[model samples]
Target chain A: MENPYIVEPAAITSIRQETDETKTYTLKFVERERTLQFTPGQFNMISLLGVGEGAFSITSSPLQKDDFEHTIRLVGNLTRAIDRLAQGDIVGVRGPYGTGWPIDSAKGKDIFIIAGGVGLAPLRGLINLIIERRNDFGVVEIMYGSRKPDELVFTSEYDKWRAAPNISLFLTVDEVPEGFEWTHGRGVVTNLLGLSKIDPANALAFVCGPEIMMRFVARSLTIRGLAEENIFVSLERRMECGMAKCGRCMLGRAYICTDGPVFSYPEVRSLPQNLLAASF
Target chain B: MVKSTPRALKLENLNILIDAVSQKYRTYGPVAKDGENAWEEVKADGELSLGCAATMLPAKHILQPVRLDLYSFKSSGGFQIEEPGFDEKIALFGVSPCDVNAILALDRVFGGRFVDPYYWQRRENALIVASNCTESAEESFCTSWDTGPELYSDYDLLITELADGYLLEVGSQRGKVVVNGLNLPGATQEDLKEKASRLDAARAATKKRLPVPPDDLHQLFEERYDHPIWVPNAEVCFSCGNCTFSCPTCFCFDIRDEVKPSRKEGVRNLEWDSCQLLEFAEVAHHANFRRLRIDRFKHRTIHKLSWMKQQYGLTGCVGCGRCVRWCPSWPVRRGRITSLADPVEIIADMLEPPEKVEGVERPGGVIV
Candidate 1:
């Protein structure tokens, strides 16, 4: 009986400026008791009244029931319209859709979470879940990088993540800007894989970022003696309808919206592998 | 439940059946207009263009219109959507066997995962009267895919043109209602034997075929992603998207928001879009996934021949040959002036050994 296209109204409660181009908006359903239940990597379709609709990752931790969060960048019409709105402004929200990260499969394994720029936003919920249940998992290592020092999101939570037992955080910037300050590793996120102490015997890697970045990370993990089946990557596509019917987010047989926003390296390899193509 | 017996109706009593169906639903049938067959509303006394396979378009336009409004919205207050009404109940009379196969493929696309109420509203409620293809067209290759010249499922009524008269096969209980009302004579064993011979001749008439077996097609596309044949084949592609528009199985669509002059209200519509267009895969900042002519060109051919089978159980192309007949651009092939607008031409080239020519490699799954 449910129409997937119909959206429930959610009011933006607060907005945090993550960078010059990105902002994190916290929202709650206007109906008070209505809340969207979701896992770490799943996303929601947000809309601006008459403008348009766009998909955003549910960046909030799964435990947070009263509200949800989405870190959006100034990419297109809907995001631009969303950035201009003040707190308490109501917008249409229609998901928490997609197969999220396989949280149960990685329960007893070492977790290696890698991200780039705003790509870290989608993984933030998974990171929070691991930190909260640190005893349920093994060693945790977080590697993230951005083109510039100012582009890194969730900087405030880095120290807290580092303070957690058995969790190591490695931050990097493609290049530190002039007059701006940065003290972590420099160059692409791939440069820090040499220092990672993750043992391939019992490890699960969750990666997300621009399509190009995930490709490099998957290759780096494979080169480090990790099985293709063990590495999980989040793919990006031009999704209009979160449902599989849109055909926009298709990668071979997989409809990125329904089949995955998340897929194993081996599963992705089995597809035609055009869009995430490797140089022959 | 008693099985309905097949009935034989003389050529003169054809209108009696149409009039019977019209009592329950608004009926539409093929009509000859300017030497081309077009689907038009058939009144009780209207002349039906039976025994024709020259319709310019398929039944897709009937179920999902070229521009169907999903809903209307107002920008003044909170975000809201008002779904359009689902009122009209339309039925098809004398639909081709190839198109019936096309409707089944579309039924899976819209009926799976999230059922599209808009498409099902028309497809489920309306009755279907399918007619087998007795004569093959110039471009039709439906026999290669086993989707034409005969139909086995998804029709309420099946009509086959016999040498002397018409033989009606009631495929469903609904189809029997009309035949029983007319009280037509039961078809003789000789008439049934004539139907089999007619379809066999129709199949033999189709000269074109896909060469490659259906099971091995997926592997072919995988190994030849960067085949050198795509370059020169794409050289004269105008990207006009005529092939996709005329295709019976090309179901890709793009959503558009038509804002009013005052900017206070708008209507959201989903229009059939072709991958051949540059903007079909455009994302933010004008970053296109299939920017090049070859990428868009190869995607359409490969998706239909291979990827569609992987996505859905059936191949997206029913070999209706609409793409071949509708293509506007005529690129040359071999030594003579030939049409390279057909999917068969490109897919055939990919199936063969690659020629040693300088060709650009196709881009990987790149993000915007």
Candidate 2:
């Protein structure tokens, strides 16, 4: 019998602090010969063994062999416990699950990548893929924002991403503290959209953020002339069994664990309740 | 395999037949407990509640234990999954057809996409001795769904209560093995006819009914998705989760890791969970998707009636009436009747919204 819940032990190779509350972990299966095969935008169920499991996106480039990264924000019991760990700590890994971003659908199209806070972590995989095969897609624009400038993640990788041909980066923050040197848009992420030059008719836009933020991003893109089907957003819910049997991740007919963590704007709108708001 | 003739055993000799069956399997049956029956291990010497009414919990507990450890991780061993193979060959006696239907519903859920090997392991090992209802319990509405009074199929041994003897219809080869060489008299054609008429009488005795056919429930629910009765119902609902706990087909679960004091290792366990609880749908950052009492309440009924069909091509509720019996809310007034968390009443209210009608006095609580 194949036990889906059994976690494979993986040794943490490295950890990098992204913000006061968030860190990126790089891990590889301890068996050494086994490889973590995953496409861009899919997620892995990271287990601290004693603490519990959490579903986080594979935040590294899929083109990279052996290892994958997860950018985790210290939120609940499991993640905070994850923060206490150091390099060489052994953790459990179970996935590479769910539908990934529609890379094939986005091929030969202008691309727009939108992120807010740690939401950028999920898109990082696709961003790396785009950089590696820069000629496969049209003009690529990345718009990312954090509440504060210091909260931005992967700051070291910004220069390398900007160096990719036909790829542009638009960074923003909600606010900045006193005596901080901030040279970026100073508002919500949507404000940075004004700097984008991609034609909506020829582009596919992917958005991820706080639910409210993703809701607004989808609306703004629609107003900017992108068809509802062409705009995709990733959603999160309380998930236990990523197999979709747990029933925790349900949103209307969609089990956020199975049918999507990623859904096009039209599909989101077709669901019964508003995932983006407090109302029905 | 040849179709075996139905057999007959005198009611007094039931214990003898059970003794014959016990040699090859672990027998489970309902036993009297505090005025109600409960599914329990039936020792060869112990009594069986053969003609008893509904049990508090269904036979699902036997197949899927309330708290089964999925796996354990040790500092020394690294990782180990709890046994995924069930070794016991068990036989369940007098399992109601509604409960059998519920088990089948669960099979669809666990069998989808990635099959649940743990559940399938135990479920596949067990043999069912299904029994037809001779009488209806207070909360039963099984006839409306055609899920009780009798089962057409899906059991190993089908037992029917007759006046002077037990009419045993062997449905599978395993059931044939249990009754081999018992020398019980073969059932006459007239005896099978008697069982059919008795089953029909049992069906007629279950007075409660749904407003629409079971096939149309999903569509009807979809049309009445935002029916006004929900808010008032939520106000009365205690959210105590009694309904879900007693429910036959409520398979939602929560997984927890229990680590030892040494912090060296732990075990991950899967246990029954209810959507009625406020925290069932809460994700990170204290954001609960189904935050409102009304949201949770609607989710329970809608998921059972509508969403289950969408996901698994079956009704989540098997018309067992467990939720109706266990819901804590009082006087859930629907069209022409009152019952808490009753699927029939809920659908009846959708057919005729009680609040819309004038001068309808609610039984205990107000909906108008």
Candidate 3:
């Protein structure tokens, strides 16, 4: 008899600064034998003792069993508290919840990964998995953009990602600040879609970012002739219980926490106008 | 298996059944609380009021308590979690038929997909003594929803108030155990027939009805998503959340951890939350998905009238009419809150002909 509300203690083994406002925390579950067994694109509800909890995507690849990494940005109260914690600090970890990216299902299809700002965190897992099993996928294209040069995460992994065979990495900065030596594509990440060579008919797109970014990226992919069903978008919603009981994260009939954080473009498009829309 | 045969209990002997049930379980019955009928713990038979009026709140507060501790945590332990369950068994007496249907709907929600142990702990141990609605309330439309005025099943004991006395129909083995030694006389065929006829009359007398059919309601509401009725309706909505609080079928909740002042001890509590609040959809970075009043209004209406039906096989609203009766914005007409706060009326207004309006274009129908 498992109680879903129970939170397992996880020790923060290491922490690495990803950007000015974001850091990646490497955690090891205290219960050594307990395998999280989470797929790429799934999130975990990380609790900071009495502070509260917030859902963060597991950036670590599923192949890595010993440790899990979560790239968190300092946005709200919970995230700020989490960012203040150092190595050896104990925190509550519940989940490995929600629908993950179509890793196995998208095999042999050209994978197009598009992200913006801190939204790149969840997709990082899928990128790593695809690179490890490079033979299983077609040409993999990664397009990521940050608000500024200092806001870019995983600066250390950029070389490794680009070095991977069949993986083309496209990095961009929304605006270049003075005194910052930066050489990359300029403007939003979706702008890179025109510069990339992707066969829409044979490609599967996975998008994660701000709502507007996803809408535009999804629209671009669809206009490029990709099927609406083939384009998946990861959404962020107010969540209390990772299970579907709390009604906060509901988008129409679907509970984003359970039904998906990863939903096909057609599924999101089917929701009512007020649920998710251009102005909304 | 238990017998479905109707049993007769004289008006004076109603307390005998209460006394019998109280011997085994803690009884909860409707009592006058602050000039309103509410379910309260009954210490003696004198506290019970088998009122014709509907209770201000449903029995869900007992089954699924408003603020429940999922577990308590102490700093001394190695991050251990403790789960608690209700200790005492409860018998809820005199629940309305609409509320009985509400209980069934809640059972499906908490029992399905992920079983909520906190809710089930009280639900499994509790006994249901449902009473049929003999007289309709001012805002009741339970008959239109085909959910009330008579209890068919889903309850342990059934009590139907008749002209002379009460007709007790034992539904489950637990119900028979409560009335065991009382030796209640079996109801005659005439009494049983009379109960049916009276219930039929009560159902017909419930004047209010949903404008759309049950089967077509989901599709109709889906098409009315962008209808103009939302703006003006939401404008007057204070967002006080009384409507959801009073609703028998509104089951939205929030779970949070509350720590003691020492910060060494804490408890995770699940409390009822309404979707009408602006902060209900607020996520990280202060981004609220349903920020506008209209967005929240449409979400609540669509979720209850349509989406829940698609998800759970039953419409989220049982037509208990509590929302219509309790909403602060509910228009008072002839000393009673009329259908202005009724969801049926809102949907009806949404479905009105587009030509009636001067410049507003018709909200084109779309089906998903």
Top-down TM-score ranking? 3, 1, 2
Q: For model 1, give the interface RMSD.
A: 1.9
Question: lDDT of all the models against the reference?
Answer: 0.80, 0.81, 0.81
Which docking class does model 2 fall in? medium
Candidate 2, fnat value? 0.61
Candidate 3 per-residue lDDT over residues A85-123, each given as its tens digit? 899888889898999998877999998999998989999
> Which residue pairs collide, candidate 3?
none
Backbone clash total for model 1 is 8
- Candidate 3 lDDT at B219 equals 78
Instruction: Give the per-residue lDDT digits (tens) of candidate 3, residues B45-90.
Output: 5566664436788788988778888888875424666778568799
What's the TM-score of candidate 1 when only chain A is evaluated? 0.96
lDDT of 1 by residue, B183-205 (tens): 67778888788888998888999
lDDT of 3 at B31: 86
Q: TM-score for every candidate vs. truth?
A: 0.94, 0.93, 0.94
